[model samples]
Structures are given as structure tokens and as C-alpha cells.
Target: MSDIFEYAPAPESRDVVDIRPSYGLFVNGEWIDSLGDERHKTLNPATEEALAEFSYATPADVDRAVDAARKAYDSVWGRMPGRERAKYLFRIARIVQERARELAVLESLDNGKPIRESRDVDLPLVAAHFFYYAGWADKLRHAGLGEDPRPLGVAAQIIPWNFPLLMLAWKIAPALACGNTVVLKPAETTPLTALAFAEICRQADLPPGVVNIVTGAGETGQALAGHEGVDKVAFTGSTEVGRLIARSVAGTRKKLTLELGGKAANIVFDDAALDQAVEGIVNGIFFNQGHVCCAGSRLLVQESVEDELLAALKRRLATLRLGDPLDKNTDIGAVNSAAQLDRIRELSDAGEAEGAQRWSPPCALPDKGFWFPPTLFTGVAQSHRIAREEIFGPVLSVLTFRTPAEAVEKANNTPYGLSAGVWTEKGSRILWMADRLRAGVVWANTFNKFDPTSPFGGYKESGYGREGGRHGLEAYLDV
Candidate 1:
């Protein structure tokens, strides 16, 4: 046998999933044809093959979805007791766990993420989000938001392509737990999981019109977010789009919460464990092919251990296998789409043009799919586009700092402040850095860690409001 670490193809079976040839809007707890004839193909990013064709919801469709949600809110879901809602949430969680493998396979096929990640990380977290919120369903009075927290009526939720199912759970579970009806729109590129989730809702025997899913591109999302019938609007995507949503809902009575972009900093001190820090740094940026909104794309290292860390990190990156997303052994997967890959290339090219040294290991990419190597940029200045902007790809920009103050200063320098990571053996220094960092979520000695019980959002341009825990309930509730 070859070396244990040597990559052998162990592709997951796709036979478990049955992708429908065509899909439609899930409105009033039923799949219905779109009002408009506009349709788009949902592609398998790993193979560039069209998996299925799905509808693009027109303005009328959005109105229908919003109206359905409104009716559900006023008639059934909104008036339902928290205990009854919890039963549906719990049932959904159980069904998701039972269908976990199917969802994982579909997610990898559709979203172009490694099977290891979708199976282990995304699906588990998706179930956990539902389970977590289920526990909070009947306990709103003690949630500290208010003595009697009421549902916010119809909520308009739009999720990104990166973590489709998990983001859906994040938006839906809390809204349902708080007894609010929702009309959700998944990203144009990755709507399969969301549509599957609508099936889950049906399976769970959720009330009609309680949850509506309309799949489409930007214009459909704009219609949903700007719908006057929506009592609250929540979105997870680009900051530019977040700003537009903020502007669109500015004067409306709608309560809006956004979880947008991030250019997070992962700071490693000289005193940190070199091996541990190296793993953390790699995971921070390269996990999910660095498509995460809060990915630690910026590595701020202490000047003393920069060389040592760089050498170790480079060696680790060389071992990473990038190929079929369905391959269980693959570490890096394809970029989500041609357009996203193009954006990554444009920004990476800009990094090289602006004087940063870019390096990639010997990654033999697949011929057909959208692929980008696990890239690293040393000598990356703070002003460089790679350092300042969210590449949202498998790219890490390395910069150096001298002390805790300097690390905090450099880490907080970006317009995005969603999260920051610190790796240091010294407890006091980690505490100090966490206190000083301007990001919403700061991880000490760990990166990209999330729990449904903990509230997550960001500061400034990273967008406002929290999405998990009891705080997440506040967004969907009227105190």
C-alpha cells in the first residue's frame, strides 16, 4: 500500500441523491410553478454540468410568497404557541439528521465543497441549529429580550451560496422558534439544498404558508427583501448588497439584520505552539475553499516566528489534495462558480500587481471544473487588495506584527470586522487581544468555531445584528 497520508480516490457515492430535472417555487408549503417563464440551470460546480433547472421568481412570485407568509403569520404560525412550534422545529431537526448523508452528498455535488466538510461540518451544524433553536422555542419569556416576546410576523430571509443549508437553518429555525413566518430566497447558484429543506418542512408537517422558498438571482432577492408585507428582513451575503438592502429597507417599518462580508485576521504570536498555530492558520483560510464570510483570510504573524510559520504552513499546503469535491480524501475543492472564480483571479492578480509575492503548491486541478489552488501571499501590505478585501477564496495574505497592540491594530485595520483569531499560549495576552479586537467574534487559540447557542454577527461594515442564540431570537421577535 502507498503511504497512509498519500491521497487515494475515495469518492462518495452520488447514487444516494436523486436530483429532479426541474424545480419550482415552494410556496404555501407546496411546490408550484413560477408565475414567470424565467428559468436557470443549477450547475454542479465540480463538473460544470447542469444538475437541474430551477425557476427564477418574478416580482409577482415574490409577492405571492410574501402574501403566503403574511397569511401564515397572521393565521397560523404567528399565533401558534411556542411549545407547538418547538415540536415542528424538533421534528425538522430529526428529519435533517436522518437525511444527513443525502444532504451532504447533494451539498458537495451542488456547492462544490469537499464531502468531508459538508458531511462532517455543514450538515451537523445545520441539524444542531434546528435542535438548538427548538430548545429555545417555548422559553422566550426567560430569554431576557422581554417578558413576552412576540413574533415579528412575516420575515424575509435571503441566504448566500457558501453555507446554503446551514444559513437556511440559521434564518429559519430562529424565526420559527420565535413563532414568525418567513419567505426565504437562496442564492441563485446553490438553491438545491434550500429546496430540499422545503421538502423537509413538508415532511415535518409544518403549517401551510409557514415557510416559503423562492429561488432566483439578484432581482428576485431584491423583490423579496423590498416586499412591503415583510415585517423583518434578514440577509447573509456581500457587504455591497447588504448596504443596498439596508438602504432599501431604511424608511420602511421592516426590522433588518445583515450578516455580510468579512476580511478576518488570524494573529499568531511568537509564543504560540508552532504546529497548533499552523493547523489553525490553514483551517482559518482554506476551510470551505475559503468561501466563508468570516474566514480568516488575513494572517497577522509576530515578526519573530514569521519565517518558521511560513515554512511549516507552506509544507502543509503542499500536502493538501484538490480534486473532486466528492472525494473523501480531498482537502481543497472547486471554487463555487465561474463568476466567483473570476473574481478570485481578478483580486489575486491585483495582489501580484500591487507587489505581493504569491505562491501555490503543486496542485493539479481537474480539467473540467472551476478550481483554484490553495494560495498564499507573503509581503502583503495592509493597503493591498488581497489584505483589505474579502477574497472569499482559498487565498491567505500574510502580514507581520511586533506586539499585542500592533496585532490588534493591524487586525482591526480592515473595513470588515466579523471575526478575528488569536493563537498564543499566554492566557493573559489572548484575553487582552480579545478585549481590544473590534471584531464581533474573536476566537483564541481556535478559528472558524461556531455554536448555535452563541450569538454571531459583526461590527461596522461586517454588517449589524446577531444571528445565533437568544440574541438571534430578538431579531425575529417583537418585545
Candidate 2:
């Protein structure tokens, strides 16, 4: 009775969102049909209901988009004053803020993340990203690149489904602010927000072909990335795909930036605040259902306090509510797709088969849509598959270390260097670990916090090139 009383269905009203039956591709500032007859259905991952059908971009469609972008770059946007360009971005940001509720509700409906997260985390950040980059539009001359850095002619950007709007903002905002026209391909599963963003672009009265969205799966991305007219290629997706893009553009004049996967380690020392550390651990791997590229999937704890930390973590996990994504109180939501859910299961099963002990809190999952429980595997070795691979799900692998040196060694053992977290009472030790950790973003006593002004990316296999701040502008500029 108490458990039932703890959470009641407080679902957000879906009436706020008005989804269309079919959405055409947004190219050259117009809603145009794809050249291909093939159409993909976008479904609600939480309900497995069809949200909308989107046409897949063919090679010809990609060519058309590139041509439009090139025309815009050569004729209008490329020659526009920086201050004028700034106004367009500012308008888009204001429109995003104005339509925040609709976008948030639609995002949750389409992406299967909790409404609270879509509304509170993704939507706000999307708007903030545009606002942040808008200010940089006119200030590019002072960005320290050189005197009067010029825009790369056109950027072909490919983003994944986990963060549709936010990733779009990250890629498109900086490129547009730098005066580059864009041909962007949104992931097939989450193209609605990108198309809606296209509408926002129209509302801003952005120059035609300045920002075009070509929707499709991997093939469309390949067509866009390999397109000869593109001057730059920026991608945020799997490392496998990123490597493919890198190879596709080899010897070409295209400037490339790839933000790929991560297997971050969250280290908690014995002297740290135990309760707060537990919360950070929860937020690290479970936030966004652990779909984050920089998710702290690896937990490295000082052996002396491992027992206490695990106990507290399990207690906290038990209280997490999992249900309808639109439910305001739901903490965990559906996995983004059935394919992603399968990947999470396969990796987790490998953990158990490889001698790690798997545990999940007792919770009933919805029967209708894709779902995965918040899971943890203890007694994991460095050699375990779960420890090394990017599961990209709500799963964590715990490893214990006796010394700070051992902790650092275990943390840096992975090929990915995207993000890491360190928790300790001693400030000096935090600095030491942070300095040694090879990841791009290091959070001390915190996890999964983001800001538009901060640079975010990875080192090594996690991929090169930062995505935010002034460093992001370098990718789109010709210095």
C-alpha cells in the first residue's frame, strides 16, 4: 500500500503536441518530398505507436540539399554580416523557449526519455546552446583564431537519436553562427524534433538553404558525409560510424569533427561524502537512462568503502520510479528503441556469463514498449566485457581499488576518454586524479552536469574535436 501510494500516475497532457501524419524533408527552407519513395515510420519508443512517417533521403536528395547549401553559402548566408546572423540565431532561441512545452512533450513522446528530463534537461539546454552561440556570431573576430576567421563553406552534420534536439543544436548552432550553411542528417528514430527545428528556422526567416535537414538512416549520412560539395563534416554517433566517416573523407579537403562513445569511470574515495556519492553514481549512469555518450558507466570505488557504497546505492535504486515517460514523477523511462534495449541486454548478459554478479532493483516494467531496468554488476574485473564496452544503457559495472594509483590505472585502462568523475574530501587528491584522468571533461564530486559555455568532447577512441565553447567554433572556421 505504501509503495503504491509513493507514486501515482501524473502523466503530462499529450494534447499539447500536434503530430503530423507525414513529414517531408526540410531542404532549402522548404518542406519538400524526398526523391526516394521509401519512407520510415517514427515510433514512440515508450508506446511503440507510430508517431509520423518521414521520407528517407536518397543520394539525389543529398545532392539537392548540398546544392542548396552551397548556393546559400555562395549567394547569401556566407556574405551576411555577423551581427545580422546573430539576430537569426537569437530568434530561433526565443522561438525554442516559446515552444518549450510542446517540444518537450513531443521529445518525450518520440524519444522515450522522461518528460521531466526532456522538459528540464534537454529542452533548456537546446535553447541555451543557441543563445550561447548567438552571442559568438558577431564576436568571431575576437575569438583568438586570427584576424577575421572565415566560415567553412558548408558543413555536413550527422547526429544520433539519443539527444536529437540537443545534438542538433550543438552541431547547427556553432556552424550557423560561424556563417556556414548546413546539410544536416538527423537519426531516423528521432527526426521529428529536427524537422520541428526546421520550422523554427523558417519562423526565424533564416536564409533559404542556410540550414537544411535531410532525414534518413546510415545510408543518408554516408551520402551527405561523402558529398563533394561539403566543406566540413561534423558527426556525433557510434565510434564505428565515426571511423567510417573519417575514412570516407580521407585525402579530401573536408574538415572533420567526431564526438563518439565513452565508458567513463566514476571514482569515489573513502573520505568522500557517501550519500552524495551514491546520488552522483545514480545520476551518472541512470540519467537519460544512461544513453549519454559520456555516461559514467564504470564505477571505481576505494575498496575500504565499497561495501558501504554499494549498500547505499542499492537502497537508493529501490526508490526510483519507472513508468510512463510523460509521468512527472517517473525517474526512469523506456529505452530509446528495441534495438538499443537488445544491446543493453546482450552486454549485461555477458557480464553475468563472464563471472560478474548482476543485480537489478525489483520493479515491474511496462509490457507495451521497450524497457530496461537500472542494473549493476559487481565483482567485475577489468577484463570483463561490460567494463570495456560502451553499453549505452542504464547499466553499471562496479570495480574496487585499494589505492589511488590503482583507481587511476583502472580508470584510464579503457580506450575511451570522454568524461570521468572524482569524489573525495581532499581537494589536492581531486586535482591529482583529474590531472591524470585522460578524459575531456572531469567532474569533481559531481556527474552529468553540462553547460553551453564549457567545451565537451573526448580523447583517443572517444573521438577528437570539442563541441561547445570557443573551441567549437574552430571546427567551422577557416583560420
> Against the true structure, candidate 1 has what lDDT?
0.94
Query: Once model 2 is optimally superposed onto the true structure by TM-score, how far is the C-alpha of residue 36 displaced, in angstroms?
Result: 0.9
lDDT of 1 by residue, 275-390 (tens): 99999998999999999999999999999999999999999998898999999998899899999999999999999999999999998888998999999999999989999988
Model 1 bad stretches (over 4 Å): 1-5
lDDT of 2 by residue, 1-479 (tens): 45455556788999998899999888999999988999989999988999999999999999999999999999999999999999999999999999999999998988999999999999999999999999999999999999979999999999999989999999999999999999999999999899899999999999899999999999999999999999999999999999999999999999999999999999999999999999999999999899999999999999999999999999999999888999999999989998999999999999999999999999999889999999999999999999999999999999999999999999999999999999999999999998899999999999999999999999999999999999999999999
Q: Give the lDDT of residue 401 in candidate 1.
A: 94
- Relative to the true structure, how large is the alpha-carbon lDDT of every model? 0.94, 0.95
TM for every model, in the order presented, reads 0.99, 0.99
Q: Once superposed on the true structure, which residue ranges of model 2 sit more than 4 Å away at CA?
A: 1-5
> With candidate 1 superimposed using the best TM-score fit, by how many Å does residue 299's alpha carbon deviate from the native?
0.6
